[model samples]
Target: MGIDTFKEKCGYEIDEMWLPRVTAITSILNKPNLYRYFADSPNYPAAQRRLDSAAEWGTLTHEVVERMLKGEIVKPDAKIIPSIKAFQKWRENNIMRISDPEKDVERLVVDTKHMFAGTLDVVAEVNGTRGVIDLKTSTGIWEEHYLQTAAYLSAYNKTARLKEKCTTRWILRIDQYEECLGCKAKRRGKEGVLRVTGGKRICNHQWSEKKGVVEFKELEGYKEDIKAFLAAKELWEWYNKKFIRRIPNYAKN
Candidate 1:
Protein backbone atom coordinates (compact mmCIF):
# COMPACT_ATOMS: atom_id res chain seq x y z
CA MET A 1 0.00 0.00 0.00
CA GLY A 2 1.00 3.62 -0.64
CA ILE A 3 2.01 5.94 2.20
CA ASP A 4 -1.19 7.98 2.02
CA THR A 5 -3.41 4.91 2.07
CA PHE A 6 -1.47 3.38 4.97
CA LYS A 7 -1.63 6.66 6.90
CA GLU A 8 -5.41 6.98 6.51
CA LYS A 9 -6.08 3.36 7.43
CA CYS A 10 -3.82 3.47 10.49
CA GLY A 11 -5.07 6.97 11.41
CA TYR A 12 -1.64 8.60 11.42
CA GLU A 13 -0.49 12.02 10.16
CA ILE A 14 1.80 11.36 7.21
CA ASP A 15 3.52 14.73 7.03
CA GLU A 16 7.07 15.52 8.29
CA MET A 17 5.73 15.17 11.83
CA TRP A 18 5.46 11.39 12.14
CA LEU A 19 6.69 10.05 8.82
CA PRO A 20 10.22 8.89 9.62
CA ARG A 21 9.52 6.77 12.70
CA VAL A 22 6.31 5.46 11.19
CA THR A 23 8.13 4.49 8.04
CA ALA A 24 10.84 2.67 10.00
CA ILE A 25 8.28 0.87 12.15
CA THR A 26 6.31 -0.17 9.10
CA SER A 27 9.48 -1.32 7.41
CA ILE A 28 10.13 -3.72 10.28
CA LEU A 29 6.64 -5.19 9.99
CA ASN A 30 6.76 -5.16 6.16
CA LYS A 31 9.96 -6.82 5.03
CA PRO A 32 10.81 -5.97 1.40
CA ASN A 33 11.10 -9.58 0.20
CA LEU A 34 7.91 -10.62 2.00
CA TYR A 35 5.97 -7.76 0.37
CA ARG A 36 7.38 -8.60 -3.06
CA TYR A 37 6.27 -12.22 -2.84
CA PHE A 38 2.86 -11.65 -1.23
CA ALA A 39 1.76 -8.20 -2.41
CA ASP A 40 3.19 -8.19 -5.96
CA SER A 41 2.44 -10.45 -8.89
CA PRO A 42 4.82 -13.34 -9.47
CA ASN A 43 7.39 -13.00 -12.28
CA TYR A 44 6.87 -16.47 -13.71
CA PRO A 45 9.64 -16.38 -16.33
CA ALA A 46 12.24 -15.06 -13.90
CA ALA A 47 11.22 -17.61 -11.31
CA GLN A 48 11.52 -20.41 -13.86
CA ARG A 49 15.04 -19.31 -14.84
CA ARG A 50 16.18 -19.43 -11.21
CA LEU A 51 14.66 -22.86 -10.72
CA ASP A 52 16.39 -24.10 -13.85
CA SER A 53 19.78 -22.85 -12.65
CA ALA A 54 19.52 -24.71 -9.33
CA ALA A 55 19.80 -28.25 -10.69
CA GLU A 56 20.56 -29.56 -7.19
CA TRP A 57 17.67 -27.85 -5.42
CA GLY A 58 16.89 -31.01 -3.49
CA THR A 59 20.48 -30.99 -2.16
CA LEU A 60 19.81 -27.60 -0.57
CA THR A 61 16.74 -28.96 1.20
CA HIS A 62 18.80 -31.82 2.56
CA GLU A 63 21.46 -29.37 3.73
CA VAL A 64 18.85 -27.26 5.55
CA VAL A 65 17.48 -30.36 7.23
CA GLU A 66 20.96 -31.55 8.20
CA ARG A 67 21.96 -28.16 9.62
CA MET A 68 18.77 -27.95 11.68
CA LEU A 69 19.28 -31.46 13.01
CA LYS A 70 22.92 -30.70 13.84
CA GLY A 71 22.14 -27.18 15.14
CA GLU A 72 24.51 -25.43 12.77
CA ILE A 73 24.08 -22.12 10.98
CA VAL A 74 23.44 -22.37 7.26
CA LYS A 75 25.54 -19.64 5.70
CA PRO A 76 23.72 -17.03 3.62
CA ASP A 77 24.34 -16.73 -0.13
CA ALA A 78 23.18 -14.37 -2.87
CA LYS A 79 21.68 -17.23 -4.87
CA ILE A 80 18.32 -18.27 -3.35
CA ILE A 81 17.19 -20.74 -6.01
CA PRO A 82 17.06 -23.64 -3.55
CA SER A 83 14.89 -21.69 -1.09
CA ILE A 84 12.37 -20.88 -3.84
CA LYS A 85 12.27 -24.56 -4.84
CA ALA A 86 11.71 -25.60 -1.22
CA PHE A 87 8.80 -23.16 -0.89
CA GLN A 88 7.27 -24.51 -4.11
CA LYS A 89 7.48 -28.02 -2.68
CA TRP A 90 5.99 -26.81 0.60
CA ARG A 91 3.05 -25.10 -1.15
CA GLU A 92 2.32 -28.22 -3.17
CA ASN A 93 2.25 -30.29 0.00
CA ASN A 94 0.53 -28.04 2.58
CA ILE A 95 -1.30 -24.96 1.23
CA MET A 96 -4.58 -26.69 0.41
CA ARG A 97 -4.60 -28.61 3.68
CA ILE A 98 -4.06 -25.54 5.90
CA SER A 99 -5.62 -22.78 3.83
CA ASP A 100 -9.26 -22.23 3.02
CA PRO A 101 -9.41 -22.45 -0.79
CA GLU A 102 -12.59 -20.39 -0.71
CA LYS A 103 -11.50 -16.75 -0.46
CA ASP A 104 -14.96 -15.89 0.89
CA VAL A 105 -14.42 -17.80 4.14
CA GLU A 106 -15.31 -15.68 7.16
CA ARG A 107 -11.97 -15.81 8.98
CA LEU A 108 -11.73 -12.54 10.88
CA VAL A 109 -12.88 -8.93 10.75
CA VAL A 110 -10.00 -6.54 11.53
CA ASP A 111 -11.12 -3.26 13.06
CA THR A 112 -9.55 -0.78 10.67
CA LYS A 113 -10.82 2.10 12.76
CA HIS A 114 -7.46 2.35 14.57
CA MET A 115 -5.45 -0.36 12.88
CA PHE A 116 -4.40 -1.47 9.41
CA ALA A 117 -6.02 -4.52 7.81
CA GLY A 118 -4.07 -7.60 6.72
CA THR A 119 -4.83 -11.19 5.65
CA LEU A 120 -3.65 -14.34 7.39
CA ASP A 121 -1.78 -16.74 5.11
CA VAL A 122 -3.60 -19.82 6.35
CA VAL A 123 -6.86 -19.79 8.31
CA ALA A 124 -8.02 -23.39 8.52
CA GLU A 125 -7.95 -26.45 10.79
CA VAL A 126 -4.56 -27.79 11.86
CA ASN A 127 -4.97 -31.17 13.58
CA GLY A 128 -8.67 -30.36 14.22
CA THR A 129 -7.85 -26.98 15.82
CA ARG A 130 -7.97 -23.67 13.94
CA GLY A 131 -4.66 -21.82 13.62
CA VAL A 132 -2.67 -19.44 11.38
CA ILE A 133 0.45 -20.13 9.32
CA ASP A 134 2.90 -17.52 8.04
CA LEU A 135 5.68 -18.41 5.63
CA LYS A 136 9.26 -17.10 5.55
CA THR A 137 12.46 -17.53 3.49
CA SER A 138 15.69 -17.59 5.48
CA THR A 139 19.14 -19.14 5.46
CA GLY A 140 18.47 -20.62 8.93
CA ILE A 141 15.99 -20.33 11.78
CA TRP A 142 16.46 -17.89 14.70
CA GLU A 143 14.60 -17.11 17.94
CA GLU A 144 13.86 -13.44 17.07
CA HIS A 145 12.06 -14.56 13.93
CA TYR A 146 9.25 -15.96 16.07
CA LEU A 147 8.18 -12.38 16.85
CA GLN A 148 6.78 -11.92 13.36
CA THR A 149 4.64 -15.05 13.71
CA ALA A 150 3.42 -13.91 17.13
CA ALA A 151 2.44 -10.52 15.69
CA TYR A 152 0.28 -12.30 13.12
CA LEU A 153 -1.38 -14.30 15.89
CA SER A 154 -2.12 -11.14 17.89
CA ALA A 155 -3.57 -9.40 14.85
CA TYR A 156 -5.79 -12.38 14.07
CA ASN A 157 -6.90 -12.66 17.69
CA LYS A 158 -7.96 -9.00 17.79
CA THR A 159 -10.66 -9.37 15.13
CA ALA A 160 -11.51 -13.06 14.81
CA ARG A 161 -13.42 -15.39 17.05
CA LEU A 162 -10.65 -17.99 17.14
CA LYS A 163 -11.39 -21.51 18.39
CA GLU A 164 -11.31 -21.71 22.20
CA LYS A 165 -8.51 -24.29 22.33
CA CYS A 166 -6.74 -22.90 19.27
CA THR A 167 -3.98 -20.76 20.74
CA THR A 168 -1.25 -22.23 18.51
CA ARG A 169 0.32 -20.22 15.64
CA TRP A 170 3.32 -21.02 13.48
CA ILE A 171 6.06 -19.55 11.28
CA LEU A 172 6.94 -21.75 8.34
CA ARG A 173 10.64 -21.25 7.59
CA ILE A 174 12.17 -22.35 4.28
CA ASP A 175 15.96 -22.09 4.15
CA GLN A 176 16.96 -21.63 0.52
CA TYR A 177 20.66 -21.84 -0.26
CA GLU A 178 23.22 -23.69 -2.41
CA GLU A 179 26.15 -25.59 -0.90
CA CYS A 180 29.39 -23.63 -1.22
CA LEU A 181 32.80 -25.32 -1.54
CA GLY A 182 34.19 -22.71 0.86
CA CYS A 183 31.93 -23.93 3.68
CA LYS A 184 34.29 -26.82 4.40
CA ALA A 185 37.21 -24.51 5.09
CA LYS A 186 35.04 -22.12 7.14
CA ARG A 187 33.61 -24.89 9.27
CA ARG A 188 37.17 -25.84 10.18
CA GLY A 189 37.81 -22.33 11.61
CA LYS A 190 36.37 -20.20 14.44
CA GLU A 191 35.20 -17.62 11.87
CA GLY A 192 32.45 -20.01 10.77
CA VAL A 193 30.55 -19.56 14.02
CA LEU A 194 31.35 -15.84 14.05
CA ARG A 195 29.87 -15.38 10.57
CA VAL A 196 26.22 -15.77 11.59
CA THR A 197 26.74 -13.64 14.71
CA GLY A 198 23.93 -11.19 15.05
CA GLY A 199 21.03 -10.89 17.58
CA LYS A 200 21.14 -12.19 21.17
CA ARG A 201 23.14 -15.39 20.62
CA ILE A 202 25.67 -16.98 18.26
CA CYS A 203 23.99 -20.34 17.69
CA ASN A 204 21.71 -21.37 14.85
CA HIS A 205 18.15 -22.31 15.93
CA GLN A 206 16.14 -25.33 14.81
CA TRP A 207 12.44 -25.72 13.90
CA SER A 208 10.40 -28.90 13.71
CA GLU A 209 8.38 -29.65 10.58
CA LYS A 210 4.74 -29.57 11.56
CA LYS A 211 3.03 -29.89 8.18
CA GLY A 212 5.36 -29.31 5.22
CA VAL A 213 7.50 -26.45 6.55
CA VAL A 214 9.69 -25.90 9.62
CA GLU A 215 7.44 -24.63 12.42
CA PHE A 216 8.84 -21.76 14.56
CA LYS A 217 7.25 -21.49 17.99
CA GLU A 218 6.02 -18.08 19.20
CA LEU A 219 7.73 -16.21 22.10
CA GLU A 220 6.52 -13.82 24.81
CA GLY A 221 8.50 -10.84 23.42
CA TYR A 222 6.41 -10.90 20.26
CA LYS A 223 3.19 -10.49 22.23
CA GLU A 224 4.57 -7.39 23.98
CA ASP A 225 5.75 -5.92 20.69
CA ILE A 226 2.26 -6.23 19.18
CA LYS A 227 0.66 -4.63 22.24
CA ALA A 228 3.05 -1.68 21.98
CA PHE A 229 2.25 -1.26 18.28
CA LEU A 230 -1.50 -1.14 18.92
CA ALA A 231 -1.06 1.44 21.66
CA ALA A 232 1.05 3.64 19.38
CA LYS A 233 -1.60 3.33 16.68
CA GLU A 234 -4.22 4.73 19.06
CA LEU A 235 -1.96 7.68 19.97
CA TRP A 236 -1.22 8.35 16.31
CA GLU A 237 -4.92 8.58 15.54
CA TRP A 238 -5.42 11.11 18.28
CA TYR A 239 -2.51 13.21 17.01
CA ASN A 240 -3.91 13.26 13.48
CA LYS A 241 -7.30 14.51 14.64
CA LYS A 242 -5.72 17.24 16.80
CA PHE A 243 -3.46 18.38 13.97
CA ILE A 244 -6.37 18.62 11.54
CA ARG A 245 -8.27 20.85 13.97
CA ARG A 246 -5.33 23.29 14.09
CA ILE A 247 -5.35 23.74 10.30
CA PRO A 248 -6.89 27.17 9.57
CA ASN A 249 -9.81 27.38 7.11
CA TYR A 250 -8.56 29.62 4.29
CA ALA A 251 -11.41 28.81 1.87
CA LYS A 252 -13.63 31.47 3.56
CA ASN A 253 -11.25 34.18 2.25
Candidate 2:
Protein backbone atom coordinates (compact mmCIF):
# COMPACT_ATOMS: atom_id res chain seq x y z
CA MET A 1 0.00 0.00 0.00
CA GLY A 2 1.07 3.59 -0.63
CA ILE A 3 2.08 5.87 2.23
CA ASP A 4 -1.31 7.63 2.33
CA THR A 5 -3.26 4.38 2.17
CA PHE A 6 -1.07 2.83 4.81
CA LYS A 7 -1.55 5.79 7.11
CA GLU A 8 -5.33 5.57 6.69
CA LYS A 9 -5.43 1.83 7.33
CA CYS A 10 -2.95 1.93 10.22
CA GLY A 11 -5.80 1.70 12.67
CA TYR A 12 -9.13 -0.03 13.17
CA GLU A 13 -12.47 1.65 13.89
CA ILE A 14 -13.96 0.90 17.29
CA ASP A 15 -16.91 2.75 18.83
CA GLU A 16 -16.31 5.59 16.38
CA MET A 17 -12.61 5.73 17.33
CA TRP A 18 -9.56 4.42 15.51
CA LEU A 19 -7.03 2.25 17.31
CA PRO A 20 -3.58 1.82 15.77
CA ARG A 21 -2.66 -1.51 14.22
CA VAL A 22 0.09 -3.66 15.73
CA THR A 23 1.82 -4.32 12.42
CA ALA A 24 1.69 -0.64 11.52
CA ILE A 25 3.20 0.25 14.85
CA THR A 26 6.00 -2.29 14.55
CA SER A 27 6.76 -1.13 11.01
CA ILE A 28 8.41 2.02 12.33
CA LEU A 29 11.61 0.26 13.36
CA ASN A 30 14.71 0.45 11.18
CA LYS A 31 15.75 -2.66 9.23
CA PRO A 32 19.39 -2.70 8.18
CA ASN A 33 18.91 -5.80 6.01
CA LEU A 34 16.17 -4.08 4.07
CA TYR A 35 18.43 -1.11 3.53
CA ARG A 36 21.15 -3.39 2.19
CA TYR A 37 18.63 -5.07 -0.09
CA PHE A 38 17.72 -1.74 -1.62
CA ALA A 39 21.35 -0.65 -1.86
CA ASP A 40 22.32 -3.84 -3.65
CA SER A 41 19.48 -3.58 -6.15
CA PRO A 42 20.16 -2.07 -9.57
CA ASN A 43 17.64 0.68 -8.96
CA TYR A 44 15.02 1.72 -6.41
CA PRO A 45 12.00 1.41 -8.76
CA ALA A 46 12.79 -2.17 -9.77
CA ALA A 47 13.38 -3.19 -6.17
CA GLN A 48 10.08 -1.60 -5.14
CA ARG A 49 8.22 -3.40 -7.93
CA ARG A 50 9.64 -6.72 -6.84
CA LEU A 51 8.75 -6.02 -3.23
CA ASP A 52 5.17 -5.06 -4.18
CA SER A 53 4.71 -8.16 -6.29
CA ALA A 54 6.09 -10.40 -3.57
CA ALA A 55 3.70 -8.84 -1.06
CA GLU A 56 0.72 -9.62 -3.30
CA TRP A 57 1.90 -13.18 -3.75
CA GLY A 58 2.32 -13.57 -0.03
CA THR A 59 -1.20 -12.22 0.63
CA LEU A 60 -2.67 -14.72 -1.82
CA THR A 61 -0.91 -17.57 -0.06
CA HIS A 62 -2.13 -16.38 3.32
CA GLU A 63 -5.73 -16.18 2.09
CA VAL A 64 -5.62 -19.70 0.67
CA VAL A 65 -4.14 -21.19 3.83
CA GLU A 66 -6.60 -19.34 6.05
CA ARG A 67 -9.54 -20.63 3.98
CA MET A 68 -8.21 -24.17 4.13
CA LEU A 69 -7.77 -23.93 7.90
CA LYS A 70 -11.42 -22.91 8.16
CA GLY A 71 -12.35 -26.36 6.72
CA GLU A 72 -13.09 -24.94 3.30
CA ILE A 73 -11.52 -27.04 0.58
CA VAL A 74 -9.28 -24.81 -1.46
CA LYS A 75 -7.17 -25.27 -4.58
CA PRO A 76 -4.23 -22.99 -4.16
CA ASP A 77 -2.53 -21.34 -7.09
CA ALA A 78 -0.13 -23.52 -9.12
CA LYS A 79 2.79 -21.34 -8.04
CA ILE A 80 2.07 -21.81 -4.34
CA ILE A 81 1.12 -25.50 -4.49
CA PRO A 82 4.45 -26.65 -3.10
CA SER A 83 4.22 -24.42 -0.06
CA ILE A 84 0.64 -25.54 0.57
CA LYS A 85 1.67 -29.14 0.32
CA ALA A 86 4.42 -28.57 2.87
CA PHE A 87 1.96 -26.95 5.25
CA GLN A 88 -0.46 -29.87 4.83
CA LYS A 89 2.29 -32.36 5.53
CA TRP A 90 3.34 -30.49 8.65
CA ARG A 91 -0.27 -30.29 9.85
CA GLU A 92 -0.70 -34.02 9.41
CA ASN A 93 2.57 -34.90 11.10
CA ASN A 94 1.99 -32.72 14.14
CA ILE A 95 -0.66 -32.80 16.84
CA MET A 96 -2.02 -29.38 15.99
CA ARG A 97 -5.55 -28.10 16.18
CA ILE A 98 -7.20 -24.76 15.51
CA SER A 99 -9.13 -24.19 18.74
CA ASP A 100 -12.09 -22.48 17.11
CA PRO A 101 -11.93 -22.01 13.38
CA GLU A 102 -14.45 -19.21 13.30
CA LYS A 103 -12.87 -17.16 16.05
CA ASP A 104 -9.29 -18.36 16.13
CA VAL A 105 -8.46 -18.19 12.47
CA GLU A 106 -7.43 -14.67 11.52
CA ARG A 107 -8.81 -13.53 14.85
CA LEU A 108 -9.26 -9.83 15.36
CA VAL A 109 -7.89 -8.64 18.67
CA VAL A 110 -7.79 -5.27 20.39
CA ASP A 111 -5.87 -3.86 23.35
CA THR A 112 -8.19 -1.21 24.73
CA LYS A 113 -5.79 0.10 27.34
CA HIS A 114 -2.98 0.41 24.82
CA MET A 115 -5.33 1.47 22.03
CA PHE A 116 -3.99 -0.92 19.38
CA ALA A 117 -5.54 -3.61 17.23
CA GLY A 118 -4.59 -6.43 14.83
CA THR A 119 -5.86 -9.59 13.22
CA LEU A 120 -3.70 -12.50 14.35
CA ASP A 121 -3.17 -15.49 12.10
CA VAL A 122 -4.13 -18.45 14.28
CA VAL A 123 -4.89 -19.37 17.85
CA ALA A 124 -3.81 -22.97 17.91
CA GLU A 125 -2.23 -25.79 19.85
CA VAL A 126 0.81 -27.59 18.50
CA ASN A 127 2.14 -30.64 20.32
CA GLY A 128 0.02 -29.83 23.34
CA THR A 129 1.28 -26.23 23.59
CA ARG A 130 -1.41 -23.64 22.96
CA GLY A 131 -0.33 -20.30 21.54
CA VAL A 132 -0.54 -17.79 18.74
CA ILE A 133 0.73 -19.06 15.36
CA ASP A 134 1.75 -16.33 12.94
CA LEU A 135 2.09 -17.33 9.30
CA LYS A 136 4.88 -15.78 7.21
CA THR A 137 5.85 -16.14 3.54
CA SER A 138 9.06 -14.16 3.79
CA THR A 139 12.46 -15.54 2.82
CA GLY A 140 13.53 -15.45 6.45
CA ILE A 141 11.94 -14.57 9.75
CA TRP A 142 13.27 -11.38 11.31
CA GLU A 143 13.20 -9.71 14.71
CA GLU A 144 10.25 -7.53 13.62
CA HIS A 145 8.18 -10.67 13.05
CA TYR A 146 8.75 -11.64 16.66
CA LEU A 147 7.66 -8.18 17.75
CA GLN A 148 4.55 -8.39 15.58
CA THR A 149 3.53 -11.77 16.99
CA ALA A 150 4.35 -10.68 20.50
CA ALA A 151 2.04 -7.71 20.15
CA TYR A 152 -0.74 -9.97 18.89
CA LEU A 153 -0.28 -12.45 21.71
CA SER A 154 -0.34 -9.72 24.33
CA ALA A 155 -3.42 -8.07 22.89
CA TYR A 156 -5.20 -11.41 22.54
CA ASN A 157 -4.53 -12.49 26.10
CA LYS A 158 -5.73 -9.20 27.48
CA THR A 159 -9.36 -9.88 26.52
CA ALA A 160 -9.29 -13.67 26.43
CA ARG A 161 -10.76 -15.90 29.10
CA LEU A 162 -8.43 -17.87 31.36
CA LYS A 163 -8.46 -20.99 29.24
CA GLU A 164 -8.27 -18.99 26.02
CA LYS A 165 -5.10 -17.15 26.93
CA CYS A 166 -2.09 -18.04 24.80
CA THR A 167 1.02 -19.29 26.57
CA THR A 168 3.49 -18.39 23.81
CA ARG A 169 3.88 -17.27 20.21
CA TRP A 170 5.30 -18.88 17.07
CA ILE A 171 6.25 -17.91 13.55
CA LEU A 172 5.40 -20.43 10.82
CA ARG A 173 7.34 -19.65 7.67
CA ILE A 174 6.22 -21.33 4.45
CA ASP A 175 8.42 -20.98 1.39
CA GLN A 176 9.42 -22.85 -1.77
CA TYR A 177 12.78 -22.92 -3.49
CA GLU A 178 14.81 -24.98 -5.92
CA GLU A 179 18.36 -26.07 -5.13
CA CYS A 180 21.13 -26.47 -7.66
CA LEU A 181 22.20 -30.08 -7.97
CA GLY A 182 25.84 -29.22 -8.40
CA CYS A 183 26.39 -26.21 -6.14
CA LYS A 184 23.50 -26.59 -3.70
CA ALA A 185 22.52 -22.95 -4.11
CA LYS A 186 18.84 -22.24 -3.46
CA ARG A 187 16.81 -20.20 -5.90
CA ARG A 188 13.50 -18.65 -4.94
CA GLY A 189 11.12 -17.72 -7.73
CA LYS A 190 8.36 -15.59 -6.36
CA GLU A 191 6.32 -13.11 -8.34
CA GLY A 192 8.27 -14.05 -11.46
CA VAL A 193 11.54 -12.84 -9.94
CA LEU A 194 14.27 -15.42 -9.44
CA ARG A 195 16.76 -14.79 -6.65
CA VAL A 196 19.57 -17.13 -5.72
CA THR A 197 21.21 -17.43 -2.34
CA GLY A 198 24.41 -19.22 -1.22
CA GLY A 199 26.70 -21.56 -3.18
CA LYS A 200 29.29 -20.82 -5.86
CA ARG A 201 28.74 -18.01 -8.32
CA ILE A 202 29.86 -20.13 -11.29
CA CYS A 203 28.57 -23.65 -11.61
CA ASN A 204 26.99 -26.20 -13.95
CA HIS A 205 23.70 -25.13 -12.35
CA GLN A 206 21.51 -28.23 -12.62
CA TRP A 207 18.45 -27.36 -10.55
CA SER A 208 16.57 -29.95 -8.55
CA GLU A 209 12.83 -30.24 -8.17
CA LYS A 210 11.14 -27.32 -6.46
CA LYS A 211 10.59 -28.16 -2.82
CA GLY A 212 8.77 -26.43 0.02
CA VAL A 213 10.27 -25.58 3.39
CA VAL A 214 8.26 -25.07 6.55
CA GLU A 215 9.96 -23.64 9.61
CA PHE A 216 8.11 -23.28 12.89
CA LYS A 217 9.95 -21.26 15.49
CA GLU A 218 8.79 -20.27 18.95
CA LEU A 219 9.49 -16.65 19.92
CA GLU A 220 10.43 -15.94 23.52
CA GLY A 221 10.60 -12.84 25.74
CA TYR A 222 7.19 -11.35 25.04
CA LYS A 223 7.64 -8.96 27.93
CA GLU A 224 10.54 -7.29 26.15
CA ASP A 225 9.07 -7.69 22.67
CA ILE A 226 5.84 -5.96 23.57
CA LYS A 227 7.82 -3.16 25.23
CA ALA A 228 9.81 -2.72 22.04
CA PHE A 229 6.60 -2.77 20.01
CA LEU A 230 5.04 -0.07 22.17
CA ALA A 231 8.18 2.00 21.86
CA ALA A 232 8.00 1.61 18.11
CA LYS A 233 4.36 2.65 18.22
CA GLU A 234 5.33 5.85 19.97
CA LEU A 235 7.97 6.56 17.35
CA TRP A 236 5.50 5.78 14.54
CA GLU A 237 2.96 8.21 15.98
CA TRP A 238 5.60 10.92 16.25
CA TYR A 239 6.67 10.37 12.65
CA ASN A 240 3.10 10.58 11.42
CA LYS A 241 1.83 13.15 13.89
CA LYS A 242 0.83 15.56 11.12
CA PHE A 243 -1.12 12.97 9.18
CA ILE A 244 -2.53 11.42 12.35
CA ARG A 245 -3.74 14.77 13.57
CA ARG A 246 -5.95 14.95 10.49
CA ILE A 247 -7.64 11.64 11.29
CA PRO A 248 -10.90 12.71 12.87
CA ASN A 249 -11.52 9.56 14.88
CA TYR A 250 -7.96 8.58 15.67
CA ALA A 251 -7.14 8.17 19.34
CA LYS A 252 -3.74 9.82 19.73
CA ASN A 253 -3.06 8.32 23.11
Q: Count the backbone clashes (under 3 Å) in each candidate.
A: 1, 0
Residue-wise lDDT of candidate 1 within 178-202, one digit each (tens)?
Answer: 2223222111011121122223343
TM match of model 1 to true structure: 0.43
Maximum-lDDT candidate: 2
Query: What is the per-residue lDDT of model 2 for residues 1-253, given as tens digits with 9 covering 90 to 100?
Result: 4546855678787878888888888878777667755765689987787777788889988999999999999988898999999999988889988878999999999887777899999999899999999999988889899889988988899899998888999999999999999899999887457888888998988888899989999998999998888888889889888777777888765
List runs of model 1 lying over 4 Å from the truth: 1-25, 28-81, 88-96, 104-109, 112-114, 127-129, 140-148, 162-166, 181-222, 231-253
lDDT of 1 at 77: 42
Per-model TM-score, in order, reads 0.43, 0.93
Candidate 2 global lDDT: 0.87
| Deviation (Å) of 234 in candidate 1 | 5.5
lDDT, candidate 1, residue 109? 28
Q: What is the lDDT of residue 104 in candidate 2?
A: 94
- Cα lDDT listed for each candidate: 0.41, 0.87
- Stretches off by above 4 angstroms in model 2 are 1-7
